[model samples]
Target chain A: MARVATGDAFTSTQRAEIDRAIRDAETVSRLEFSVYVGRSDGETRPFAQRLHAALAAPARSVLIVVDPPARIVEVVTGGEARRVLDDEEVKLAILAMQSAFAAGDLAGGVVRGVQQLAEHARKPQLRHTD
Target chain B: MAPFHALLILFLLPAGLFLVITLLVYLPSMRHSEGYQPGQVWRGEPEWFGGPRKGVEAIDETEPAAVGSGRDGGESGRGGASGHW
Candidate 1:
């Protein structure tokens, strides 16, 4: 079997759920979404930002970095991504995730964060635009 | 050969065997005996480090250029925030 992620971080079932949530979030926001669950080698924020920059399209991607042992959660938005997912919206997602992690619900926290970000970033359908 | 040499060798043989057995079996089990251990933090190396990846790619420290890494193929600015639980 392909061990895509660290086994202990999430079981196969849980990983599938989280992956689905990420895909759904991407669809809603029309942005790239990536999630990383591992220990942070350095400062969590900088490490997350580094990870964000390395993505294929940094400007339109949303990167979520979770350092479980450190109990840290960071939501990074690319340039274009930030326009739709504003700072406050990102903070709200972080807050939600933090609570979930505090309660030892890693998968739940990620799913909730992804949903919240996607919700905040979703473009409202214009009923009438001449 | 000294008279006490045989006795010393006999004592050392058992002692060495016991040490080898302890190292081979006992220590590792005790070190990781806990029910579950969460994954370690990112340290530039993981089991799948050099292997081909799909979807999300881990950060490469030396290479700043976004070659085939990102999904969107756009430049990213540092615009996100962080929080601790």
Candidate 2:
């Protein structure tokens, strides 16, 4: 039997689920998605933006940062990504995640939030474009 | 019936049943307890999933560049939302 690492924030199974959610979101959105689960260095928003800025392709990426202890969640979107995912849409996803977090479902909240963002940001099908 | 056989069935049956019931009651809770709860401070290092190659270490050293320098100017182009539980 594989020994569970008690020090980890998420178990192996939860990690797998989060990974799957990211993968699916990328496939749907054609945008990179990153999730950070831990403490914020300072103000949560700036920490999240810094993390987003560090992405290889920040202009096409979305970063979700969740600080459980601080009860803060921030979603930072890049230029191209922001075109598709407005603040209103991102706020809706945050609300979904916040409710889940309040219930102590950290992994589930992340997964759901990622999926929701991707769903909202999915490129509208280019139908009948000459 | 043999004395050992009777004792084995009578004693082991209830013991096994009790063990099964206990496991059934506790298994879900054990799974749920794995992750951090609200307002719980995390002792583990921060984790970034599907992040840049340098991972969490890069963020501290690298200042946020002019991200989203598109039609929208400065940070205004970089849109997102913040929340708390």
The prediction achieving the highest lDDT against the true structure is: 2
| Residue-by-residue lDDT tens digits, candidate 1, B1-85 | 6758876678877898889998988675454322213353323221211112642344554266643233233444447778998
- Give per-residue CA lDDT, model 2, range B35-77, as digits (tens): 6544455675788999977887887666445533432346547
What's the lDDT for all of these models? 0.70, 0.84
- The lDDT of model 1 is 0.70
User: Model 1, range A1-130, lDDT digits (tens) per residue?
Assistant: 3223333555445567778888898888898888887677688776676776666777788888887667788887887898888889999999999888877677788889988999999998879857
Question: Which residue pairs in candidate 2 collide?
Answer: none
Residue B55 in candidate 1, Cα distance off native in Å:
9.1
Clash count per candidate: 13, 0
Docking class of 2: acceptable
Stretches of candidate 1 off by over 4 Å are A1-7, A128-130, B1-58, B61-77
